[model samples]
Target: MASSAELHQRRSAAVARGVSSMIPSYVSTAGGGTMTDVDGREWIDFAAGIAVTNVGNAAPRVVEAVQAQVERFTHTCFMIAPYEQYVAVCEELAALTPGDFDKRSALFSSGAEAVENAVKIARHATGRPAVVVFDHAYHGRTNLTMALTAKVMPYKQGFGPFAGEIYRVAMSYPLRDGRSGAAAAAYAIGQIEKTVGAVNVAAVLIEPIQGEGGFVVPAEGFLPAIAAWSRAAGAVFIADEIQTGFCRTGEWFASTHEGIEPDLITTAKGIAGGLPLAAVTGRAEIMDSVHPGGLGGTYGGNPIACAAALATIETMRELDLAAAARHIESVARPRLEALAAKHPAIGEVRGRGAMLALEVVIPGEDTAAGPAPDAVLTAAVAKAAHELGLLLLTCGTYGNVIRLLPPLIISDDELDRGLSLLEQAFASSL
Candidate 1:
């Protein structure tokens, strides 16, 4: 097999410059919480393909399902010939997503597509134009999602002239904002009423736990408050659970943690055991408002992907991965907290279940002068971890947060070793 170096040269020649990889080593095989590179080196995986492979890479059931599906059929285009697997997947989504009322689902190819369709459905249902998002939120890379996104660098740098009527408000970032959940919600609601006017608002879109925007867990009561306001204003409340769904946050969905039921929820990443499948699931009435033929794509709900999703969901239920995620939190969070106590650079350690993060910052003395984001230190720590054969990923609007998204199925030994390597990385970097 060609080495990673040789492959890198070819990739540099062929792939677009805009596309980037977290690590240089190319994978030969991956499973559970570890990945083997072409050079025969093994690395403990802490980033599950940006939270995609929650059931682990190449899970047995998912593999068997995909194989069986490939032998039977690949694609007839659900819009053209339709398929049982597609409908089955949708049915599963309706049953799984957060709502007791009659729910409906529409599948798509990627998270971005799911988000776009959610917004489209919200606008159509509410008959309004303005969609409200929050600060430090990341929806996706598409045109409309870029408008919905808050960060400018990398995701929306020069891709300007974005879609219109997307308004942004302050998010309940506890560490930085220092506002209680109720206070923050009131502030955001005030901004919407003052600037966008509740009458013109179509949707209030937000991530339950902001993913790429630093895994900023909104303070308690924040999500419920926003959902209440959206309901009172006759707006569709959308929870972008693309990164935090599928038991990644210790629940089937993060919104459930706060007892908030969004009118619409966009899910992807962990939904299909790494296969590209996304969905917009919501109340039946709202989803049906878009009329027939308005919310589908050519490759949406591919049979192989649907099969993978079915197997993925089954594995999650059978294994009780939601509890597995909570167990991971129990094992990892204390270690992370201990590390923070030892290193001042770790300004804060936050997140839930397997989705955790360390916000790197330049230490400060007084409360008035809050900690400053230390992106340089964050990058150095990640690089050192990579050299130690531990995979890591960094995120945040300021690019100073090290987010840990280990597979829910990671073994205890593997998880401990990964955390040890991370400790060593921080020590050497400091």
Candidate 2:
């Protein structure tokens, strides 16, 4: 392996500046729940490639599947020459995702692609042109998705001419909104009814647990109400589970807890155990709304990615990762809440299952008021973690949320180690 200094220099010189890397550009080796730098420095990985390594890094099953697929064949393009692995992954999605109704699945290369395609299927099926989103939601970077997303600075800034026909409504961020589920739903519906006209809306897309918007779990009954509203309005309910799906949120999908059978659900990240694969699974009738040539891509469902996804689904089943994730929530949430109490700067600690975040408030830690958590404190904690051999990510529309998406495969000791580092980071920051 190359030296960290040389590797970092090469990365800065050659790699595109468009992408932002976590600290210590060189992670020497990665496996299971940890990564190391070329200098033999180890780091506990909590970010998990933004929830892509749910089964953990270099998982045995995933590696075996990918290695075997490489030996046989790589790509033939599902549009031109369909493969079994792709179908198998779809079959798994149909089986795994919650819902009693018949389902269908379509594959894509990324979360954003899957999101965009779900909207397509919804619009085609409903014969409507308008789509509704929520405030503080982070859908994707594609033109339409960027428009659908609520954040504006990083993902949206400098990106012009975002696709149109996308509308947004306020979400019940209990920390901020301080409203009941019915009130929040009514607020959102009133906005759409007054502005977009529900008849023209094809879909109402949402994150079961708002991921980039600081992992805000919407007030209870909110999702079910929205699902009912979508049906009443004759629009498809598209759950943008890209961040909350595939056993990351305790359940197989976050929406399962609310008992909402979405007309369409977009998923990615953990679905392939780190490979580039995404899927849109929902009612077969809605999925088949589009014409034969309307859906698909050159490498939408590459055989290798499909194989990896198949293995990932199987791994989730055999290992019972969903139960493991709930176990994580059971042990982690109280500890995090305790940390929040000790570190007054932490404005809030919220989320479900393994998907959670701590909002770093400026003066909120020490005093009752300060500039509402604007990126300053969270950035400090993230950097502090980096120095202490830990990788983390900062999110939120305000940029003050330290969202934790640790690999679901982390051992109990490793999880404690990571949490200790986090406590120390906050302590030092304070």
Candidate 3:
């Protein structure tokens, strides 16, 4: 096997510079929370391919299903030559997604496409022009989604002129705003009502638990209140569950935790056990509102990806990964909380189930005034972890959060080892 250094040297000459890699090494194989690089170095994976491998890397059932699918066929876009796997996957989505009402789903190749279509459906159904988004929200990188996302650098930077009529509102960030859930909701509601009139709004889109934006879990009552407001205003309530869906947050979807059934839910990351598959599941009426030809891409809902999705869903249910996510939280939260207590640089430990994060900040800041973000220190800690062979990720609008997205199937011993390495990283970086 080629050393990572040699591979990287070759890659620099071949791969596009704009395409960035978090880990410098090339992976040779991975399964169940661990990966081996081309150089034969082993790593305890906590990123889970950015939460896409909730069923674990190359899960047996998923591998078998994909192999069978490959033997049968690969492509045959659902739009042209429809397949049973596509229909079956949609049926499973309807059954699994939140909301007791009749739900319909549209399969796509990525989260951005799901989100973009959800917005289109919302706009078409409501006959409205404006869409509302919250601060620190990350929808996607597509032109329309870039307009919806809050971050400026990398995602949105140099990518304009973006889609218009998108309005930004306040998010119920408990750590930053120091407001109660209801108060935060009220504040956001006030902003929407004033900036984008309720009569003209098509959708109120938000991540039930923000991803990439620091795993900022809003306070209790925030999401429900927002959903109620959207309903009363006749706007679609869209939950961008692309990152928090599946069993990542100990629930089929994070909106269920708040008991909020969004009119539209966009899902992707963990849906297909790491295969490229995404979906928009919503109330049948709103979903069907779009014209038959209005929503679909040539490669949308490819048969092989659909097959993988079915197997992934089966694996999630068969293994009860939601309970596993809760178990991960039970084991990891206290350790992270203790780490926070010991390290002054660690401002807060937040998030749910297996989707958790530690917000790194300047030490000794006034508690009432909000600690300042320390992105440099956060990067240093991440670098230290990487050197120690722990694959972790950093996120946040301010880039000061160490987010952990360990696979639900990871062993407790691996979690402990990762945590120990993380602690050492923090200590050494500080």
Clashing pairs in 2: 28-36, 344-365, 345-365
Whole-model Cα lDDT of every candidate shown, in order: 0.95, 0.88, 0.93
TM of each candidate vs. truth: 0.99, 0.97, 0.98
Is candidate 2 or 3 superior in TM-score?
3
Candidate 2 on 320-410: residue-level lDDT in tens?
A: 9989889888878989999988877787888888898998776533322233665777898899998987798988888889988888888
RMSD in angstroms, candidate 3? 1.1
Candidate 2 structure lDDT: 0.88
Pairs in steric clash, model 3: none
The sequence of per-residue lDDT tens digits that candidate 3 reaches over residues 1-430 is: 7889999999999999989988899999999888999988889899999999999988998999999999999888787888899899989988988889999999899999999999999999999999999999999999999999999998988989999999999999988899999999999999999988999999999999999888999999999999999999999999999999999999989999989898999999999988999999999999999888889998788887888899999999999999999999999999999999998889999999899999999976655537889999999999999999999999999999999999999999999999999989999998
Q: List the residue pairs that clash in candidate 1.
A: none
Q: Candidates ranked by lDDT, best first?
A: 1, 3, 2
Where does candidate 1 have its weakest 10-residue lDDT segment? 363-372
Cα displacement (Å) at residue 91, model 2: 1.0
lDDT per residue (tens digit) for residues 308-364 in model 1: 999999999999999999999999999999999999899899999999999999887
What lDDT score is found at residue 205 in candidate 3? Answer: 96
lDDT of 1: 0.95
Model 1 regions more than 4 Å off: 365-370
